[model samples]
Structures are given as C-alpha cells and as structure tokens.
Target chain A: MNKEWPLWEVFIRSRQGLDHKHAGSLHAADAAMAIENARDVYTRRMEGVSIWVVESKHIHASNPDDAGALYDPANDKAYRHPTFYDLPDELKHM
Target chain B: MKNQSLIDYTLHLADNALIIGHRNSEWCGHGPILEQDIAISNIALDLIGQARNLYQYAAELKGDHATEDSLAYLRDGWDFKNLLITELPNGDWAQTILRQFFFSTYQYFLYQQLQHSKDERLAAIAAKALKEVTYHLRWSSEWVIRLGDGTDESKQRMEKAVEELYAFTGEMFLPTDYEKELATNGISVGPESLKEKWTDKVRSVFEEATLASPFKENNSAWMQSGGKEGKHTEHLGFVLAEMQFLQRAYPGAEW
Candidate 1:
C-alpha cells in the first residue's frame, strides 16, 4: 500500500500543431490511466487535440556533463548555419 | 406562465447538476491521489457549468427579473426537484465513484434523447451538455471497475457503496408531474424511456468489475423517493446552506 505508482511524461499536440510537445508528468497505475491523468492535468482548458504519454523510465536523456563535448563543437562551425547560404529574394519563406 | 411545466423541468435538471457538483467539490483537495483530485474537481466544474446553462434557461422562461444566480442561490431545499441520488452524502471514494457512475450513465442516455426534444433551446442545451456527460460516464465507469476489482479492502468498500446507493437509483426514473407534462409535449425526455439502456450499461460494467447487480437480486426493492417533489433528506439542506452562504450574505456581490 505504501508503494508509489509509476511516473509518466505527458505530451500534448495543440489545435494547430503537428507535433506533440512535452506538457508535464504525473503518477498513474498504467498507460491508460496515465493518458487520462495527462488529460485532466494538461488539457482541461482546450489546450490540445491529441495526447501521448510515455513512462518516465522508458525515456532516455543525454547527461548534462556531456553538454560541452556534444554541442560546443558545432557552435564554432559557421558553415553549419543555414544562414550562410544565399537565398533569392523571390523565395520569401526560405 | 404558459411555460410553467418547462420552467420547472429545467429547474429540476439544474438542481440535479448543482447538488451533485457541490458534493463532488467536497473532495477537491481530499482525493487519495493528486491526479484524481484534479479529475474530480474538473467533473465538479463540468456539472456546475451544466447547471448554469439550465438555470439560465429556466430564468428566461420564468421572467420577472429572475436570473441564474437567483434561481440557484436563492432557492430553498424544498423547491429543488433533483432526484434523491444526487443529494446523498459522499460516504467514501467508493461511494462517490459509484454514485457518479450511476448518475452519469443515466445522464448519458437521457441527454442523448433530450438532444432531439421539440423545444429548440432545450435540444441545443442537451446537445452541448451531452459531450461533457459522455466523459463523466467514462471516467466514473473506469473508477468503478478499478475499485470493484482491486484489493480486498477496495472490493469490500465498493460492495458496501453499491448496497447503500442502489435504493436511491430508482428515483431517477420516477418522473415528477412537471416531467410527465413536458414529456408529452416533446419538451423533455421521459425518464422511464432511459431506464433500460441505463440498466444495460450498468450491468455490463458491473460484470466487468466483478460486482453483483443489486437489481438482479431484488427487482422490487423499495426505493427512497420524493426529492423531485421537494421532499429531500437533511443532507441537501446542509448542502444548500453552505453553497448559498456567499450570495445570501452579500446579495448582488461580484468580484
């Protein structure tokens, strides 16, 4: 009876969105309950058209200690920037 | 007024929502789990929202400067026409879940038929409220199954709740005079017509939950009634006193 339920990470796709963004996390006994908890927690105010829930333990995250090695090398590479390419004025969105 | 029956019928529907919403709100911060706390609170809000719509419609029909707030906050317990089941105390988590499941199942079928009412305004309100009621039925049904089929303590508590609550379920289908009058004019859905569908849904859910249907054992069990005619248990008086305190203390007050 003292045991804690598993945690789930909630993702919500807003009315105009194609991707589900991380909303928050909650505790539930199972995946079905997790989705419902997410609905009550995150989407009560018409915030989303869709919901996705993943068990917290199933999600893998990069270590914060690897930040410099993983990301700093690309920072000094100016050519990696798409801004380096010239675009025609006629191609407005690009 | 020419629409007295419709007005009373609308008020009955409003009272049912408000009283149940008030009961559910009592669990706002006291739920066993935080997630469930929010879930019950959301359901309470939805019921209150439905109450507001029905009250507004009733007020319009009643005229004479009546408003939704006045209709809801100023009415006495004896004037309320909600079924007895809605005003019963929330004994425990199991009782609250079972009461919600029973009431929501009835509402699901009732509103589905009401959406086709000859009265355009009533039909429109029913159509809008049906979406919220559908979710209520699902949430409460899931909880009923979870608790009924859970550990021994949970199962025992659910059984006790079923026993305590079954006697009140009959009153939902016992139409009051206003209901009977409005049903004939197609302005209201007859409660009698929704009984079979409600029973089917409840029996199916009970089978999954591993709980025996009380109706199966005693089809002719004596049911406590009279709430629709304004004869309510003492519980509703207490509920109204607390709910109406603010409005009574400070008339016309607004934030």
Candidate 2:
C-alpha cells in the first residue's frame, strides 16, 4: 500500500529462443516483488519461459519532442542497409 | 468398466472435478492477494476443464444426446457422484489447500494407475490428466507449508483444517462394490494401492509445514461410500443450482 513504490513493466519470453516481449505492467514495493508479481499475472497460462520487470521510473525514454530528430533520418539511411553490398564471386560460388 | 456401465465411473470423475473446482473458483478475486488469486483461478480452470472431459466421456458412454452442458447443468444434485470432501466449501485458504492436496494426491496416483488401464480410452484420458494433476499437487503443497508455518493465526487455521478434513479421505480411498468388480475384471483400478502414495504425499508436506495430521483417535475414519454410490453432501445441491442456473435458464444457448 505504499505510494512511494513505483510501477514496473513486465516482459515475457514465451520460449527458449524467443526475445522478451512486453506483456503487462504491475506495481510493487520492490524489484523482487515486481518480478514475482509479473510471473503470477502474465505467466499463469504458460505464457513465458522468462520474465523481466523494469521499474517504470528507472526506464529512460526518447521524448516525443525529440522523436522526429532521432528517427526520421534512420528511416531513409540506405547505406546502413545490407542490400547495398555487392556479392563477391568466390562467396557466391561457395 | 464395461462399455455399458462406464457411465457410472465417468460420472464419479466428472462430479469430483465439478464440485471441487466450483469450491475453488469461489477464491477468484478473493484470495489473500493477487498472486494467490491467479494461482487459485488457474487450478480452478484446470479442474473445470478436467470435469468437462469426464462429463463428455460419460455422455458418450451413456449413449445420450446430452452434451456435457446438459449433464452438468440440467441434472439434479442426486445425480452427482462427487465425494463429500469436494462438496465441503472452501472454509479458508488452508481448507482449500488441504482439500486440493488430498484430492490431487489421490488423483495423481489414481491417474498414474489408470494410465495403464485395460480400457484404451480411459488410459489415454488418464495419461493426459496426469500432467495437470501433477501441477495441482505442486501448487497445493507449496501453500500448505506456507500457511502452516506462516503467522500464528494462519498456522492455527491450517492446523484446524488438517484435523477437520481427515474423515473425507476414507471415502476417497473407499473403492465401491462396482469398482471392485471392475478392478477384478481389469476394467477399473483399485483405490487401496493409491492410498499409500497419498499418505506419503500428505506426510511429507505436513512434516515440512510442521502441521499435525488429523488425529486418528476417536475419529470415525470408517464411513459409507456415498458419492461413488450417487450420494453427496448437502452442499452439492446449491452448487448445482448456481452452476446450472444460467445454462438451465438459457437452454440450447452457446456461450
């Protein structure tokens, strides 16, 4: 019931080879309890093999005001893509 | 276990799940906390799923057009075959744990025995059910210890539940005459062999939790096998009423 404790986001990895995906959020007095809560809430249906809980306040984010500056250029950066590379003849032969 | 008489056996299994699961489902949104609520609901849903399987099989065995819905909802309470233990309400979290622990222990051993049953369909169903009952055992055992050794109030309540819940085990192990005949003919399994493992399971949990088993002294352990014979506790009637209320009201409707 302590108001000072922060919310935490829950991520679940459904299978051994899967990446952790956001499942839900919960409030807890501490990180350990947060992880435990996440497990109870999100994984009851065998929904995950792994669980991660990040204290909501501890997670930093790009501001909405800065999204255009941070992401617009990356969208059109063709040089950063793998398609720009020419295939070597020896590699192709193998 | 005859193809014709299998209806009785199947009804007993369905009634056990429906009754016990209904009692457990009452814990939804009312467990000690959110985690416990989720755990209880998880087990409740499993029991209901299990009951559905049994009911469907029973209907098929009876050659009735009745689906699991009609069998569960439309039937009178006398038609139910669950033991009195399952009909006992969830008096507390401890009661719930003790009830589940007792039932799951019996179920695990029973299903394991049934896995090798001569009846291929029963064997297959038991094999699939063994996994679910195994998890139910784990969940119930964890809480039995936690509650038994928890705060003073919790410890007292859990200990009391252990004592009060004793007599019910007799009926669980009381293989009926029909069941005996089936076991003799290799159609059904006996509950006697299942009793040893159930005792061991209960003993280990009680040992860790430091709770005493129900006192055997002056206790009426020998009781009639009512449920297997189609008799039930008074609670079953109300449970049927509530469980069947909607289905009965809206007959032929699909959820």
Candidate 3:
C-alpha cells in the first residue's frame, strides 16, 4: 500500500481586513498542493477570498500536559485592560 | 421548420442535457477526489439549468403539448438526442476531462451561434449559456493540458483518453434534420459552421496541453452516430432508470 501524505491546517480570509481563521484541515503532498486542496476542501461555494496553508507539524503549541502552569499567571492581570481609557469621538466604535 | 417541428427540436436538445446532467450527478460524492467530484457536479448543475430553460421554451413553442416535467421525467432514454460523448461512461478522471473538454468546446461554439438565432427566446437562452459555457470550456481545457503534460502516468492516461474519447465527440456537431430545417427557415443556426470553430478551439487547447492534435496522432474517423437522432448507448438506459426511478415510482411527486 502507498503511504499517505501529511495533513495540513487550512486558514482562510473570508474578505479583506478579516483574520485568516482556521477553516479546516486536509491531507496534501506539499504546501503548494495543500493550498489548492484547501481551496477545494473549504471554498467550493466561493466562501473565501484568500487561503493560507501550513503543515500541521510546523505549528508550535503550549504543552497540553502543562496547561495549568502556562495559564495560571495571566489570569490575574486584569489591570492590563485598555477598557478604562475612553476613546476619542472619532474612534467611538473602537 | 414549422413551430411544432421546432418545439420537437428544442425538446430533443433539452432531453439530451437533462439525461446527461442526471448521469453526471451520480458522480457527486463518489469522485476519486473531492475537487473533481464538485467540478463534475457543478457542470451537471449547469447543464440541468440550461435544459430547464430549453425545455420550457420547447413547451412554449409546442403551445402546451408537454410541460417541462413531462418532457424531462416522462421521456424514455431513446427520446434523448444528446451526442454519444455525454453518454459514454465516466471511465476515469482523464476520460471525464476528455468528454468535458470536447463537449464544452462544442457547447461554447454552439451557444455562440445560438446567440445569433432569429428567435428572441433562443437567443436569450444562448446568450446566458454562452457565458457559463466559456468558463466550463476554460476549466476543462486547462485540466486537459495539465493532466496530458503533467507526468508519465497522467500523460499515458490522457493520450489513451483522447484516442478512446474522440469517436464519441463527432456526434456533437452533427446537424440533425431539424437543425437543418430550422436554419434554412431562419429560426435557428445550422450546426455545421460550429464544427470548424470546435476544431480550432480543441486544436489550440490540445497543442497547449502538449498532446497530439487528434489529426496529428491518427486521422481515424472513429464516429458512431445516431445519438442526435435519439439513439443512445447501453449506459444511457441504466442512467435513465436511476434518474426516472423517483419520478417514475411516484408520479408527480415533489419536495
């Protein structure tokens, strides 16, 4: 039997100014093929305007085994919020 | 042709699209790959949409002899006048592309000629179809080029495909008696003129794809006609069974 190619994570920007949200994942032979595969996999209905595909292996993440240690400290930093500062009239929506 | 004859002609063309579109729909979720699956289904939808319009026009032309549903659902496979190319089994991805590339090329030219039809209804439908067909033609042409030149495996399959598929392609532009009669009376365009345009378009795409221009590889007049005359392949009968099963089993049933 033939070996399967590695899987990649797919991210898509639905429109300009929007973040490249993680849409889904699919298997591909390489990065270039990944983007094309993502196009077919995720955007058949013309949902996204842009696509970015990266090998799932290339992504680094905090250790799920050490999750509490990585998260306990930042929980107390409420003072870091910018909510106290009022926006100017031109920036009212922000 | 007289108005009644013209309506028969339109129903003939419409039935071809309807049956083939129904046949293609079988591949929707079962394609070897997801992208290709969607692409084939998309083409099916396009053909079905086009058939809906043509069948409606046929009904109007007949002054209410048969509704679109009657023309589509009630008709036997023998009544469909589509070319043999569309009815050929989807042998493989390469074969599918070959059939699509050939059909879309003919469709593009045929619709272009149809856009100039004397009848306003036909002209309008052709104008709309011309735009969709342009995209279909381009997409199929691009895939043909890519697969034909991509690798040894793909190249061999594609070469085999072109040779195997060419026979069925000829029926597409063959002028039926109805097409001839309508053209003489100024209601529709003769399909003969579009043959050259189809040849030129197919030649360029084949050249770009690095495959032998059919004439370059082997000048074989591998044609099996009678499709445009409402005869069809064995595969068409099975396809009709599936397409008509729901409608046939429960007459006039709708969602």
DockQ winner: 1
lDDT for model 3 comes to 0.80
True contacts kept of each: 0.85, 0.46, 0.23
In the range B15-117, model 3's lDDT, one tens digit per residue, is 7677667767878999766655766787789889999999998877666467888877788877777787777787878888888888888878877888888
Q: Which pairs, if any, clash in model 1?
A: none
lDDT of 1 at B40: 96
Error of 2 at A91 (Å): 6.3
lDDT winner among the candidates?
Answer: 1
Candidates ranked by DockQ, best first?
1, 2, 3
lDDT of 2 by residue, B46-110 (tens): 88988898888888777648788888888887777788899887888788888899899899999
DockQ values of all predictions: 0.88, 0.34, 0.24
For A1-94, candidate 1 gives per-residue lDDT tens digits of 5669999999999976478899999999999899888989999889999999999999999999999999999988988778877788888766
Q: Rank by TM-score, highest first.
A: 1, 2, 3
Off by over 4 Å in 1: A83-86
Q: Which of the CAPRI classes, incorrect, acceptable, medium or high, describes model 3?
A: acceptable
Q: State each model's CA lDDT, in order.
A: 0.92, 0.81, 0.80
Please give, as one word, the docking class of candidate 1: high
